[model samples]
Target: MIVKTKAIVFSAIKYSEADLIVCCFTQDVGIKTYLLRNILKSKKSNLKTSYFQPLTQLDIVATNKDKGTLEYIREAKVLLPYSSLHTNIVKSSLVLFLAEMLKNCLREEEPNPILYMFLEESLQWLDEHEGVGNFHIYFLLRLSHFIGFYPDASNMKHDYFNILEGNFQETKTSEYCLEGETVENFKHFFNISVDDISSIKLSKTSRANLLELLLTYFKLHVQGYQRPKSLSIINQLFV
Candidate 1:
């Protein structure tokens, strides 16, 4: 069957001399891999391999066998063309880091419209906005809501945030706790929206520490989530 859907490119691996195995998260199908034969063979090819860059949003007409095997796209075009995501160096690095995080964390094989919509809208916002130093921090924080581990911030007045428990506690009882400046910054984000993320500023060191803590929180709650290797590169870029 033919399906028209919107997909976010997660990662593309060169399969052979001229082929690419592209993994994408589709609004209609959660996670799908497509074999794009000869997409990289020539500049004259109808399917420009550039369309498959990390985190690009595309509108595609694809063949869906729905058989748990590799599918193929018959037609594809940019759905939401980014203004500066790929061209701006800082924004590009952010996209790369985000793509790697998504690749590691998004493992579902079924459609999740809510998650898809959140990603689609969020990326568009990232592209349009400036001063995005805090983008990834808030992005991952919001993502936890869909992944089932968004921090419980109802007790926001507490002095300590228990990472393993995913909530604020009156007192720290374990090693997995956020205290002092880190707790202040982390808790500030719990109630923020995407429009307000950039306003929650941090120094380079503070930002790096917060990212580490967020990944630690993820590792504790998510069974298979791995800290993204692109993390250091992103931190270095912002520095």
Candidate 2:
């Protein structure tokens, strides 16, 4: 089937000397993997390696096949051209870390226009903004809303947040609970938007603690989700 849609590049791996296996989350077909044959060897090809960078948004014309077989892209062009997402150190780190997180969680092959729009617009916002030190934390928390595990903020006044239950409680439920300053910081995120993420100042230690809490929350809620390996690098950059 020939389909043209907007796609977010998740991860690309070289399949051979001349070909690349690119995994993308498409607005039309959800998650699709395309095999770009001879992309590396053909100098005349329009599909350059630059087009497949992590989280680079593109409009693609592609042919889809069976689930396990590789789909092929006839043409692709950058849909939202970013000026500094790949070059700026802070944004680039966030891009790498978020890309890994998305790769792990976005496994469905069904169209989710809401989720796709959220991702595309959020990334574009990140690209156009400055002082995004807290962007990833806000981004991950908001992502939970679309992924079916947004934390219940109705009991925000409670002392503990039960990670597994996705709600708050008067007391701790398990080892996967947040208390003290962590709960306080998590509460602030719910009251703000992506544009205001940086307005809430956080110390290095507090940022690290909140990040750990969010990742733990993801592990408890998201089935089959693994922690991103680039997390440590991202943490260091934030500090």
Candidate 3:
């Protein structure tokens, strides 16, 4: 099947001296892995290695056999080419970390237009903006909505957020819950655009705590979702 859709580069691994295996989350079908033969060393190939960087958006024409075999792209062009996302140290770290998170959580072969929009637009916003201290946290929390485990915002009066139950609670149900000032700060994210994140301020320590809480929520919901190895890099860059 020929698929022409917008996709975000998830991760690309060098298969040999020249070939590359790229995992992309496409707007047409949820997730597709493409084998880019000789994209690295072959100067004759039109597809360049720069087009497959982490979280880079592209319009790709590809063949999806759907026979449990790896797909390959016939043509690809960069979409919404970023200015600072790849150049700035902080933004680059966030890109690497978020790319890892998306790679682990997104593993479907079905079309998801809503999730695709969120990713494409949010990353573009991050690239254009300056304040990004809360981006990763906001990104993951909002992402849970499309992935099946966002916190229930109806019960805001409750002091504790039960991670396992996916709701607010008057009392803590398990060790995997959010309480204290963290709960208060966390709730503010439930209904706000990424651009408004500047209004919600947190100390470096507080941000770290909330990030940890969010990760715990993910682990309980997403099977095989291990902590991203690039986490420390994000924490350090933001702090």
Question: Which candidate should be chosen as best, given TM-score against the real structure?
Answer: 2
lDDT of 2 by residue, 1-239 (tens): 88999999999999879999999999989999999999989999989989999999999999998668999999999998999999999999899999999998888889999999999889999999999889999999999999999988998899998888989899876886778997888899997878778889899889999999999888878789899999988879876
Model 1 TM-score relative to the real fold: 0.95
Q: At residue 106, what lDDT does model 2 achieve?
A: 80
C-alpha RMSD (angstroms) for model 1: 1.4
TM-score of 3: 0.97
* Alpha-carbon shift of residue 150 in model 2 (angstroms): 0.4
Per-residue alpha-carbon lDDT of candidate 1 for residues 1-239, written as tens digits (9 for 90 to 100): 99899999999999989999999999987899999988887776667888999999999989989898899998899888899999999999999999998988898889999999999989999999998999999999999999899988899999998989999999879888768888888887877788888788789888888888898988888788877888878979765
User: Cα lDDT for residue 183, model 2?
Assistant: 82
lDDT of 3 by residue, 1-239 (tens): 88899999999999988899999999988899999998888888889999999999999999999988999999999988899999999999999999999999989899899889999889989999998899888999999999988878899888988888989988877886778988888998888988899889999988998898899889999989989999999788766
Check candidate 1 and list the clashing pairs: none
Candidate 3 residue-wise lDDT at 135: 88
Off by over 4 Å in 3: none
Candidate 2 Cα outliers beyond 4 Å, as residue runs: none
